[model samples]
Target: MFFASDNSGPVPPQVLAALTEANTGYAMGYGADAEMVEVTKRVREIFEAPEAAVHLVATGTAANVLALATLCQPFETIFCTPTAHIHEDECNAPEFYTGGAKLTLVPGLPGFDDKMTAANLRATIAKEETRGVHGPQRGPVSITQVTERGTIYSLAELQELTTVAKEFNLPVHMDGARFANALVALECSPAEMTWKSGIDALSFGGTKNGLMGVEAVIFFDPKKAWEFELRRKRGGHLFSKHRYLSAQMLAYLTDDLWRDNARKANENCAYLAEGLRRADAPFLHEPQANMIFAALPRATHQRLFEAGAAYHLWDGPLDGDPNEKIAARFVCDWAISRDQMDHFLALIA
Candidate 1:
């Protein structure tokens, strides 16, 4: 039972097939391939932005940092939650790519919820620009959908945060590494989740869904498209064999494959969540979209680990009392099967 991460899962057969088809002949280098043309068209069609600018990078870090750098200046500071992926996982790539821009973490209210509120964001933005040139200026506000704690933000929540940012005329960027999962969970249109909600740019992810490795950076305004291209090239993320990336993305967007994959993942998570509930496992947060944070007793965790179950422990020590409960993270990928989930739940039982 591999509930470790979606990134560790296998690529879909269709994606590999598309790669094989794209490998048959020579193609232009540096994003000029014909496949990329179709990929852009499909992305525009999906997001309903005819004038949107889309570019592919090999990793989500490249996508996030490049997009942020394009929308922000080096002297400014990006506002995000302390638990944001850019803050915790990207290893300062956002700061490095933005050419020395600082990250000012917006502290959430006193609660387990890591999602930033409009009032908190307003307070955070207000705290900045006070030090003049000595302190960093307020840059763009970055929102992480399906937040780090495995919670999905609602449309109204997004609009509220964006409205707060717009009060200061700040551009907003979305860290959409799990964009499809959140979209499917909310049952909202892509436009509603993004531009209509005041998102200026997005890091549209695919690797976590089923692709081998590809993430698209989309700018709704299209004004900073060239700057992003230069930044991507400078970061060495522009693949010479660009058709492979484009091919995977095209396959993902075609026949509603992306939506289907996300639905499967969410369904799997819901199934697992129900089983966990039956097993009396306490949830750290409600399973929202393909990810769960639940606490199982140390004895049960040890048993699962001995039975070859894979997952992440969110907190507490495994070596202490056997009855102690330790928080663990279980991620359901598109490829995870119900049989595997049943086996895992059986182990816990």
Candidate 2:
């Protein structure tokens, strides 16, 4: 049983079928294929924006970095949480792709929950932009749904964050590597969760769900589309035989497969979390999506690992006292089943 990451799971049949169909044709290269054309149409139709510009890349980093670079000048700084994937996980690709635009982490204020509210953001923008050219001017604000901390922002919270950015006349960007997961949890319309919330750009992820690799960069204001295309090419993220990537997304969006996949993964995590809670395990963060971070005794950890159940220990070693407790990071994927989770829980028990 592998609980290391959703990225490790097998792709759905839809994805492989689309890939097979794409392989049989001699399509145009570099995103000019018919499959890509359909993906753009499908994504726009779902987001309810006929005029929206949709572009596809193979990784979430490309989607976030390119979108931010398009929205910000080289001298600007992107504002996000210190725990945002763009800041902590992407190795400064956002900065590198944006020609060195800095990331100004918005430290969560006292009593603030999983999100940076409009007020906290207002205070941050006011404090940071006060430097007057001596420091980085305000660029776009990037919000990570299913935060690295495994918590989600409510629709009201999302709207509030976007409102804060709009007050500063700055565009908003979302690092939605967990877009489907957040959507399933929030149970809101794609438009309501994004554009209607004043989000100007989105990094719509597919890799963490079921696809081999694919992510879409969607811009509500289509005016910024071509510049992002150029930035994507410049960043070397533009796939040459791009139909493979486009086909994956096409299958993912068809018949709401992305949403269903996320729902199943989240359900599996909830099941796992229920089991952990029943065992009185300590949770490190709010288990909102497919990822769960919980602490168990070293004895339980050793028994689980020895039983071939794979996951990552977050805070302590595996070779410690049997009574010592430490946190572990567990990720459930779309393909994981209740039976598998049950088996894993039985191992720990």
Candidate 3:
């Protein structure tokens, strides 16, 4: 049972098939490929932003850093939660891409894991731009929909944060590494989660859902489209074989495959969450999408590990007292089956 990460899952056959079809014919290089043209059109239609500028990258970091760099300047600071993937996981790629732009991590509520509130964001934004030309200027506000802790920001919460950013006249960027999963969980339209809710740009994700390695950066305003293209090339993220990336994204956006995959993943996590509750395990946060953080006895964890159940421990060690509780992170991907979930639960029991 592989619950390590959604990134570990295999690609859907549709994606592979699209890649095969794209391989059979010659196409223009760079973003000029016919497949890329279709991808741009499909994405714009899906997001309902007829004027949106969509670009493809091979990785989530490329998507996020390129998009953020387009919105921010070298001297400005990006506001985000401490647990944001750009801050905690990207290893300074944002900093590198923005030519020294700093990330100001807004502290989360005391009990929550780095999901920021409007109050926290307001205070954080106000604290910046105080030093005028001496201190770092406030840049865009970057929000992660499915927070690192696996809790999603509701529509109301998004409105509140974006309202605060608007008060500061700062743009908003959404790190939607799990966009499809969050959209499925919220049961909202793509536009509702993004531009309509005041998000200026989005790192539209596809790799985590089912694509082999492709992510889209969408700027609703499209004013910075040229700058983004230049930044992408400078950062070495521009794919010479661009049609391959385009093909994967095209398949992801077509036939509602993105939605179907996210639904299956969320359903799998829900099933796992219910089993965890029945096993008397405690949860660190509600399983809102395809990921969960749950607590169980170290002995039970050991048994799970021995039985070949793969996952990550959030806190505590595996070598402690047999009955001591430890937190573990379980991520359910689209391909994970009920049988795997059942087998894992049985081991814990």
Candidate 4:
């Protein structure tokens, strides 16, 4: 049983099929092919933003850093949560792409793990804005959907956070590495969850959902379309044989595969969370989408590890007493089955 991360799962058959179709004959290079045009059109239609500018990159990091670069100047700061992926995972790609822009982390919601509040945002942005060009001026507010702690920010919570950013005229950027998972959980339209609710740019992700590796940086206003394209090319993200990326994305979007894949992943997580809770395990943060952070006794962890189960420990070692609950993270993917989840639960038990 593999619960390490969604990243470890197999790609769906449809994605492989699309890739095969794309490989049949010659196509144009450098994202000039017809496949990309269809992918772009489909994305715009899905978001209900007819004028939105959409670009695809091979990694979530490229999409996020490039999008931030398009939104903010070099000296500005992007407001975000302390545990945001851009802050913890991307290794300063945002700063590099934005030519020295920095991230200012906002704190104090809960669970290291709760939603960012308007008060915190106002205070943080206010502090940044007071610098008068001395400090990093407030730039965009970057939010992570299905945030780092496996919790989701509700639409109201999201709107309120964005409202605070809007008050300071800060554009909102969502680092949506799990965008589909969050959207399915919220049961909201893409536009409602994004632009209509004050988001300016979104790193619409596909990698964790089921795609091989592709993410879209979608700007609601197309004004920066050319700038983003230029930045994408200059940053070396514009794939020379771009059709492979396009094919994967197209397969992801076609027939709602993206949503279905995320739903399955989320359902698997919910099931796993249920199993853990039934076993009297306490969660570090509640499972909301495709990820969960929970604690089990070190002995239980040892048992699972010896059983050949693969996953991550949030912190600390695994050589303590049987009753010492240590933190762990569980991520689910579409391909993980009921049998796999139950086997994992049994091993832990």
TM-score of 1: 0.99
Local distance difference test scores for all models = 0.92, 0.89, 0.93, 0.89
Error of 3 at 21 (Å): 0.3
Candidate 2 per-residue lDDT, tens place, 154-254, comes to: 88888888888888899999888888999999888899889998899999989999889999999999999899888888889889999999999999999
Over 1-349, each residue of candidate 3 has an lDDT whose tens digit, in order, gives: 9999999999999999999999996888998999889998998888899999999999999899899999999999999998899999999999999999999989888988568999999999999999989999999999998888889999999999999999999999999989999999999999999999999999988888888999999999989899999999988988899999999999998999999999999999999999999999999998899999999999999999999989999888799899999999999899998988898888877
Can you list the residue pairs that collide in candidate 2? none
Query: Candidate 2: misplaced stretches above 4 Å?
Result: 109-114
Cα RMSD for predicted model 2: 1.4
Please provide, for model 4 over 187-209, each residue's C-alpha lDDT reduced to its tens digit, 9 standing for 90 to 100: 99898889988899999999888
Please state the error at residue 209 of candidate 1 in Å.
Answer: 0.4
lDDT of 1 by residue, 1-349 (tens): 9999988899989999999999997999899999999999988988999999999998888889999998889999999999999999999998999999999988776765469989999998999999898999989999998788878889999999999999999999999989999999999999999999999999998999999999999999988899888988898888988988999999999999999999999999999999999998889777889999999999999999999989989898778999988999999999898999999999888
- Per-candidate count of clashing residue pairs (backbone under 3 Å): 0, 0, 0, 0
Consecutive 10-residue window with the lowest summed lDDT within model 4: 108-117
What's model 2's lDDT at 220? 96
Q: What's the CA RMSD for each of the models?
A: 0.9, 1.4, 0.8, 1.1
TM-score to true structure, per model: 0.99, 0.97, 0.99, 0.97
